[model samples]
Target: MLAPFTPGATAFGLAHVLAGALVLVSLMMLYQDRLPALVNVLALHAALLGIAVGWQAWLQRAPELYITAAIAIGFKAVAIPLALHRIIERLDIHREVETVGGISLTMLAGIGLVALSLLVMLRTAAQADALAREDLALALSVILIGMLMMVTRRNAVSQIAGFMMLENGLILAAAGAEGMPLVVEISVAFSILIAFIVIGVFLFRIRERFDTVDSAALDAFRGELQ
Candidate 1:
């Protein structure tokens, strides 16, 4: 038998479900090649994170956490994706995502990461708060998978998607933590803004110079210069 459904227990169950969804999306991102699909997946992950935050807010009876959930839904789930879509349209970089390594290998690594996360969390952090430990383990797995995506993908757009996955994991972890104020939420939003600015600038420069957003081609250019 499982734990009884107390108020916090119910919320914890919802958050656990959200974490599972986040991991699934993270795995999907590893295999997605089309720019539009990548964006959609990122949006889904963000929306799940928002749901987790909202559940936490309701269960914990913290009205302030609701504001964090609102920002997560509004800015990450909607605004960022819309802006990225526009950028893709204007920049004409909605081409196929190129990967340095094969898709099958990337997916296998992602699976390994997920398994490792669950095993490690179950074994080492047994004494920590259950939700906190789960969040930490899930966050690390997502982040590692994102890093693998970034390294194996040779398209700027896909790399950006991978980076967003990492951010989503961090948001999940934050949502699962207790007593985190709205300021932390604002800071996360601000960090995402800064990342977008940097990525946009970098993409523009890459596009302007090479007439392509293929990271492989860009790397070749750097090689010739050296």
Candidate 2:
């Protein structure tokens, strides 16, 4: 789809909006209450991530980022979510998210993380361009939120999903950086995809042994219940 306008401030503003949308998607992923719902939203999140990165690529005329965007769209948006859905179906784990943190507290913590990202990026990337700074800050915020999801969620599948979000954040940051090598970017993307597939296989084994993919249940089997 064509951007509403093509010139200076409008393009910049739209790019900012796209990056901000990515951060919002990350925040939304934090509050997803069910496994299937979370996976579905992840597809959307990946699509948005691709769009945001593709926008950056267009603005900066970076052809390598376009490849990155294609990988995200093809693997992340389509392949991974479909694979995760099958995992959920096969494991019969379409249940509510098991979270320790209360909703209000979790949202507050996410906001604080975003604020922290802003402050940290501003201080550390003082010499970078403002647009890059904004993207990096939002990217960091997404990464932190993903980490929070992994810590708070009880299900191994949820943790995998969180890990994917974290990788998404890293991809966004790498896309924004000017000198990042194309080979390095492809390697990182495929590495993440491989890790995701490995986690899915592990989840299959987790289902057979533990009869559940919930980490608490697994821990209980080992007499390490927490």
Candidate 3:
């Protein structure tokens, strides 16, 4: 009975499992307390997202999406994390993440967010492909968890990590869609590159001016100068 399914079907099943792993890693990001550790987890998330996208390309027989996956892995998974790690080391900023609540509480909220996403997406996409619906659900969880990190943490670097994680989710969602335009995918990939350069420069400037990357402190400094 199991032999009836084609190789593509097996591959698709594996891809779904891998994409689901990305959501799990994103949840783990909410658990990390150290800056370096958080960055490491984010790198893993991005890499997993890249692989999932590549799997989608294979499933759909879309060569263009392979390029998209390469872009995702090259930048988000590798370059961004390396640059951010260097910034943290060179700037000598606080290495511990300052969170609004305990890690356990954050984890609970993330779980709730995942459940909410599942309920919403399943109901909303009843007519859609099961894999696509699953993709959206996991993607939404990643995006929400990223938002949670940004809102709860004080460190600007951590916030940037959150933002990248959010983008990772968006990429996953786009990749899972079969007929997403090639130009749109390329444009999205280009935007990630541009964002990385802009954010990198901004972080260096911020570190120079304030000698710290705390969002709360940066706001205070702006107010004082104003």
Candidate 4:
């Protein structure tokens, strides 16, 4: 069995900083209108996750976590973002993201979600390790914020980014938990890869049929067919 986690002050501080940074990046994604800029932010978010996982590996002495970190940085942070950039350029989709609600309202909702997550997680995980409890709370906030982004954005690409962000939150939680098998991490990574491929193809097909990547347009077309 794994030893009890009793991280020193510096380790806890670094962990808190990394977790907080992920939440901040998620918030940043909320108001981003430009697709390219949003992609860049997503890349940053993934890179931070990689770093955070690496830190967790060091703290937990789980060498397998290093592979998780490498996959996160190499694929999610670098390759995926580069692929998105190419997709945007190939599709010539340079328009600002179409949001369903006012930015102020969406941001307020995001803040509320964060507060709720913190309250709920802290209360429920009270007996857990301090660092794990905090990470779980912050990860929940990121997940909620990502869902908010998905609902508030009309553009398909933005929704895809939000989906990826939600997955990142899951990764954060997994990394925080002790004794999480490497196989579980590998499975999640492969699932994300498969999802990305399917979504990429779906995007191209949508563009081909509708001449736009706006999900709202697809909904309108469905309504017309009805």
Candidate 5:
């Protein structure tokens, strides 16, 4: 008979801390109006994700997850943030991000989303392992917060950061699930890379044509074209 998987207190505690940090970083991203600072926080978010995934790999004895962690750290943490910094410099975008709602209101909404995720996931995944259940709840919170950021921010760069944050949450959920395929993780990582490339192209095009990367400007242009 196969042995049931069980983790030590230390392992579970560390995983919880890392996952909580990721969600906290998402909340921090919500209040940041400066693009450069937001990108820095995004990098920190990815780094925490990588560390969390690595911890999961150690706990699950899943060697494949280490690769996923590596990809998260290398691409999302280092490469993506550096590329974004260069883009900001090249585009000369220095204005504070224009948001659709007040920071305090958005933060309250984020808190509500976290509470909703925890309540729903805990009830839904009652039969699952405790660590995995908690991870899923926090992951959902991060995903919801990312969506909130995307809808509330007007800057294209901030929207892109939000999208990436959502993807990180997906990866966290996958990492927590048993027997998640390495191939699936790799595919998702590559898809994100391709999307980043396409979005970067669009950002330059938008800036060149309209001289602004605020999404509201795109909306106005579309209105004029109509």
Candidate 6:
């Protein structure tokens, strides 16, 4: 009778579904060109991630993790999107996102990344914790897809979206680990700092100098020297 249920089982299942949906959402975010929709979807993904972490905290009875969930809900899901939207309005660079790899190919690469994650996780985890093993595989898939989006997209804002998805994966990894004290706090602070620094330097500068924040233009500038 005691062997039927396991700790973190329900929570793990919930987190897996939520994380999987977010991964698909991130894929959609990658190919999106409409600024408002992109922002909305990213915010939604952040909210889902917060919910997953909060559910995990509740199931594990860990009050410390609740704080991380709250930060995810407040800062990432709400504040960051609002700030980014304001920046987009101020910059007035509302245009369709451009991509180097195109949508179909990017999707193919996403599939490949997912398959690779499954293969790697399954092949290497003989003695690992079950929840951790699943989380690692899912998180790595999301991270790889995010990275692929970053490389394929030519719009600065879309690239930022990709970066946020990568951060989401990192949060999942942190939550899945057994003894990662201060990880959530450090990650939140670091993310905010990175975003602030990049936004301050690049967002306005791109608008001012080139009248757009297209990555291709930036790359073209670099290519001109060679």
Which segments of model 2 are wrong by more than 4 Å? 1-6, 183-203, 207-226
Superposed by TM-score, candidate 5 places the C-alpha of residue 77 at a distance from the truth, in angstroms, of 0.5
lDDT of all predictions: 0.74, 0.79, 0.79, 0.83, 0.83, 0.75
| Candidate 1 clashes between residue pairs 3 or more apart in a chain or in different chains | none
Give the worst 10-residue stretch by lDDT in candidate 3.
Answer: 203-212
Task: Indicate the residue-level lDDT of 184 in model 6.
Answer: 67
Model 1, which residues run further than 4 Å from truth?
A: 1-8, 181-186, 189-199, 202-226
Clashing pairs in 4: none
User: Tens digits of per-residue lDDT for model 4 on 124-177?
Assistant: 999999989999999999999989988888666677788889888888898998
Best by lDDT: 5
Question: What is the number of backbone collisions in each predicted candidate, taken in the order shown?
Answer: 0, 0, 0, 0, 0, 0
CA displacement after TM-score superposition, residue 84 of candidate 5 (Å): 0.4
Residue 15 C-alpha lDDT in model 1: 79
User: Can you write out model 2's per-residue Cα lDDT over 82-138, one digit (the tens) per residue?
Assistant: 877887887788875565677667878988999999999978998998777888888
lDDT of 1 by residue, 1-226 (tens): 9866687677677778888888988998887777787888888887887787788777667777777678678877797788677767766788865565688988998999899988887688788788888877887788888888877875656666677777767766666667666546564675567466646755664433242467778778778645
Task: List, residue by residue over 1-226, the lDDT tens digit for candidate 6.
Answer: 4667765566678877877786788777766667778888989988987887787677667778888888878888898888777767766766655656677888888989989998998678746887778778888888898898778765566667777888888887787776668866876685777468446735455433342467777778677645
Candidate 1 TM-score, true structure as reference: 0.81
Question: Each prediction's TM-score against the native?
Answer: 0.81, 0.83, 0.85, 0.85, 0.85, 0.83
The better-scoring model by lDDT among 1 and 3 is 3
RMSD of each: 3.9, 4.9, 3.7, 5.3, 5.1, 4.0
Candidate 6 collision pairs: none
- 1-226 per-residue lDDT for model 5 (tens digits): 9666655877898999999999999999999988899999999999999999999999998988888888889878998888778777767776655656788999999999999999999999999999989999999999999999888876667877888889889889989887777735563666477466636645654332243467788778778644
Which pairs of residues collide in candidate 5?
none
- Find the number of clashing residue pairs for candidate 4: 0
- In terms of lDDT, model 4 sits at 0.83
Location of the lowest summed lDDT over 10 successive residues in candidate 4: 204-213
